[model samples]
Target: MFRTWMRFFTPGAVHHRLGLVCLGVGLQHGAVPAVGPRVLDGYVAVVISSGRGWYRTPDGRRTAVTAPALVWLTPGVPHHYGPDPDTGWDEGFVTFTGPDTATYTELGYIEPERPVVPLADASGPRDVIARIARAARQGNPLLEVETGAAVHELLVALRRARADLAPDGDPVLHALARDACTGMTVADHAARHGMTPAELRAAVRRVAGCSPKDYLIGIRLGRAQELLATTELSVAAVARRVGYDDPAYFSRLFTRRVGAAPVRFRAQQSRAVPDDWNEGLQEDAEPGPPVAEPVDGP
Candidate 1:
């Protein structure tokens, strides 16, 4: 009969769009009966670490809960879920909300329509939830911030795991996507992986819907944006950090791709709060100057 529950009543306005103002996190075991048939005011994510259970939706749909799976309970949605009577499972859960909630929903990252999502790997989510629980129990000074950060990490892990499950998912491409900041030439990257440039291009396009060069440049540009927004680095320094030694070329590419010059973009970001800064960034804007072909790095 291992059971622990820690609840948090967070102060309002602590987090605007995506705040962890209130959280109810815990681990439970020991034949607990189904609880709910109720509605909640915020989003709740439940991760089953072991054993089995069941979840019931407002529409009278019952879903069998299996180990290493996640169930998302959207705000204002009626739901009920709990462990099996005979083999009560271990469970970890966190409730959170923020302005970015809608953004995530729009991106299909957190699907309210699909409550139960099977996690290819559950350890990451489990560890995050455990951290949230511990922070809540200790009444840490930065509990709100800590929990909010952990929630963000949990979301990222969920998205990655889900992406990995895609039919055309390629882990190698995924790694390259993350390491795009390295600024390696497409040919060099391909050679490092024992793949010809053409084969690598096809693989990246298959999973990322873009040529390897474009994919890598997109990653570099994204990093540049982050640096511009969060740091006081000059344009040339930012360009170098993202792997471009030619600052002038980097500036042209960034302006074309991001719809604003790096300096102007940084100015706008500086004027806005960090959390809401990116709201003004243009997405999928018309392509700028045609991206030059990838060249071997010096």
Candidate 2:
């Protein structure tokens, strides 16, 4: 028989504060049933590793579902889908909901308009599902929080696995980041890249979920923060390093966005750095081991 297992959760009110809660997770293969032609209260991401089927959109149009694809079922949106019972394809899915789902939607991570997405590879996201499945153990004390955290990882994995992200996602974003610390206006950057200001804005918005000016400014501030935390650079020097020649203006912006002035932020980070401080995982790295929980032994 093809494998099938699942667990549903009712995370407490406190778990919702994690910004995203894992409502449930499952894996099924062969003889799977069709879902919906109905609306959902939360969200579900159906990852098809090996299968062929069809899905209905909000407007009642039908779309093909092939292997290595994702079907996003959003809240209140009518969706219907299932695998071909004759072939019985492998499927994995997770349901999630939280206040941050809106923000994630805004950031283009949750594309409601494009519910069916092609994935470059299914292994990464499936690995996350495996982790979540392990955390679904009965009576596990940290099950809620552990599964909740895995939801964040799953989203990131799915984003990275997008078929369109290959050969480097976007040249424009890389170019913008490269010149982020340069003192160039949005118009100037656009002109240099042979794009009109409006085109630049649209491109950045589509890729980064923000305007070009805001995108560049974000990168600049991020660098400034890193320098402040890891180096003894003065505020003026840090400002210059991050393309802000005006130290006073930089301080104001930093305070407004970060809730602390540069000097104060630096002071707060004055705690000594650990020897292996930079050993943290890279953006696309696999998840580290889960927090240790004692296993019952007979």
Candidate 3:
């Protein structure tokens, strides 16, 4: 026997801009039918908290699905899956669509190539699923935003729960971020970690969705932004501080990437921060420039 509660939604364009929009969510119990060897227009994340099943892609590759596993049903991709009839199953799912799906895919948070993912523990992901289920109530004015936000959280939870990840997360990322501001070349950084440049590139791409070069530059520029906003360092000094000795080169790169010259950016940002900013700050009110549309990422 099967028991279920489900919700579906059609959000306005405004809600879609939240980057990820929840289209539907539901729970399933008991025997389940095999889904299509057909494609979908959007994406679905099916979480199996218990029981067993099987999933396959259009290419005819099949994977056995087990409890506490997740199956990724991506847009326009044919997927076939269902629970074992004899044992039945327990499942929860969310259907979502958004422009950020591509970004999430690049970041390795959503893996369409591997349709089925075994989890170290589904408890965390299930907790978030329960929250989304609660917001499923009809007449819930905040449903779109609430569930949309949860979609983001759900992705992170799913990533953390991946059976292949280290219990403490990726240590290389921490080491890289810690040393990023040192202005090391890709090869230099790779050597420090005993990885060839090609190997380093692949590892960083698999995890951070960017080349090692881009990640280091991002960190350096971010630190530059902080120093520019809070301190009165000269352009040359600021350049050197973030590991760029050539201030002219640094200024050009910063302007190109950040959309403003160093001096102008500092002036714009520092004026916004009152000297006694600690006293002037409100708990949840740090306003900034208008939100920019999403851009291409590494």
User: What are the models' TM-scores?
Assistant: 0.62, 0.84, 0.84
Candidate 1 clash pair list:
17-98, 17-99, 18-98, 18-99
Q: Of the candidates numbered 1 and 2, which has the greater lDDT value?
A: 2
RMSD in Å for all candidates: 10.3, 11.8, 7.5
Candidate 2 ranges with C-alpha deviation above 4 Å: 1-3, 167-169, 230-232, 270-298
* lDDT tens readout by residue for model 3, 1-298: 6788788999899999999999999988889777787889999999999999898768787788998899999987878899888987899999999999999998999998888999998888888888999998989999999999999999999988889777686777788788766646677767788988888888888767788777778988998888788776677766776777677888999999999999999989974556675342222233232221111232
Q: Candidate 3, which ten residues in sequence have the lowest lDDT sum?
A: 289-298
lDDT of each: 0.74, 0.83, 0.83
Model 1's lDDT to the true fold? 0.74
Compose the digit string of candidate 1's lDDT tens values, residues 28-92: 66676677888888888888778888888887888998887888999888889887778888777
- Candidates by TM-score, descending order: 2, 3, 1
TM-score of candidate 1 versus the correct structure, residues matched by position = 0.62
Q: Please provide, for model 2 over 67-140, each residue's C-alpha lDDT reduced to its tens digit, 9 standing for 90 to 100.
A: 89999999878888888778767899999999999998998789988889999899999999999999998899
